[model samples]
Target: MADPHIKSKMDWLDYVTVIAYRLGFTLAAPAILLLPWEVETGIPAQQLTFLAAMLCASSLHIYMKNFRLILQAATWGGLICAIFGFPLFGLGGAFVTLGGLCFKEYFCFRVPGLRAQPILLAALWLALVLNATLTAPMVVQGLAALSALLFLVTAVAKWRMPLHFDIGDKTKYEV
Candidate 1:
């Protein structure tokens, strides 16, 4: 059976978010791999690559969609090793990228009416913070920490909101 949650015609705003999410990932993936190479070659390359990844991550926030952006960002960060290569910028990208994924997952749970296991949520937060601490600039560490903090706070705030999520008016939790 086809998934009922799939909307036939996505709202224009939703479509825009999906496109932005894809573009962010497209630019982010290669930059993640190439950024570290910049270090051996020169800081110039590293800076450029980091800039690309950062732009992608920054752009993705507007959409709030769990699209290609998440995997691409993670792939890029993995290629570079979370907290090391091109300086704090690389590390910050890692945090933003992974943190974005974590946020997306939480948002998904809200709609799916699925509660994430507490341990899983904790691990996600830890992974992001650890990655940032290892690869990001000392100055960026604070920013990354703040970003992580924001993710947690936002998730909690949304959870407390009186909003009741439904898959669609047609479907109920019990089939």
Candidate 2:
């Protein structure tokens, strides 16, 4: 009889994954938003964020689904592009993965405001990528801020959840 309180190696890994994901988003949001002082830090926040995203995806326990692996691949693609001097393309790909994760969270946990996250993020990304004059800068910033808030709420909620919530039933996982 194993002690229920005794966490396995996988359990510890899950906690680490959640921590990395949450911290990555927490830092990446401000950095990408061009918050004051982020520029001075001179750190590659985007690259680090994508790396954390990849770790999160790798540790995700989506039973009977390859979607998690797909997300991981996207993060890798984004990271590679970012490292090779294609920051825009890398950011685009990484944001897509982030949006996907938000959608997944919304689908699974029904977090408030998350349902609109992907759309808002996509619109913001498109506006920036296309340099669309049709959409005002204020609107773009508003969307980014909103998306960040939604992510913050979701991350906080997830942080409060037990590790098992993320790990789910190991029995159902594909071998």
Candidate 3:
């Protein structure tokens, strides 16, 4: 088994940027934290959930040592945020949550060549500008959900699975 981190080719600055981006996306995922800042129900549990989510996001971002995983989490977080927020904050929340999608697509993946970066950045800016539209915001929840689902499916497919099992050795389990 080889170390996958070496294949990422991301340096310290990339890691730092990714961590900050992930933190921002995760923080924006839950609407309660973004607006009003009030506990409508399950105050204790909500507090715990919020803490756990932030803690887990940080832990995963550091421990996994993989940028893609953080991006996947960001996509899912975006989906949850967009869906929950669309009902409450409408267009503004959707636009904000779309940042998660932008993080996952633009920041996480490499452009494969140096010539493409400027173009990509321009496209990213265009994306942000277009996100302000009411039409784009209306589809944020659905798009976020789709992006998250695709990321999950790709993750599962790429994961290594165990080949051998002990199910055939029933005799050894006899008590």
Ranking by lDDT: 2, 1, 3
| lDDT digits (tens) for residues 25-98 of candidate 1 | 34433443343344455645334434444544543432223454564565366447634554444455454554
| Per-model C-alpha RMSD | 13.1, 4.7, 14.9
Q: What value of lDDT does candidate 2 attain over all alpha carbons?
A: 0.64
Off by over 4 Å in 2: 1-10, 35-45, 48-52, 132-135
Per-candidate TM vs. native? 0.34, 0.77, 0.25
Which pairs, if any, clash in model 1?
83-134, 83-135, 84-135, 88-137
RMSD of 1: 13.1
Quote the lDDT for 111 in model 2. Answer: 81
Higher-scoring candidate on TM-score, 1 or 2:
2
Best by lDDT: 2
The lDDT of each candidate is 0.41, 0.64, 0.34
| For model 1, the run of ten residues with the poorest summed lDDT | 164-173
Off by over 4 Å in 1: 1-4, 40-90, 99-175
Q: What is the lDDT of residue 110 in candidate 3?
A: 24
> Which candidate number maximizes TM-score?
2
lDDT value, residue 7 of candidate 2: 44
Error of 1 at 28 (Å): 2.3
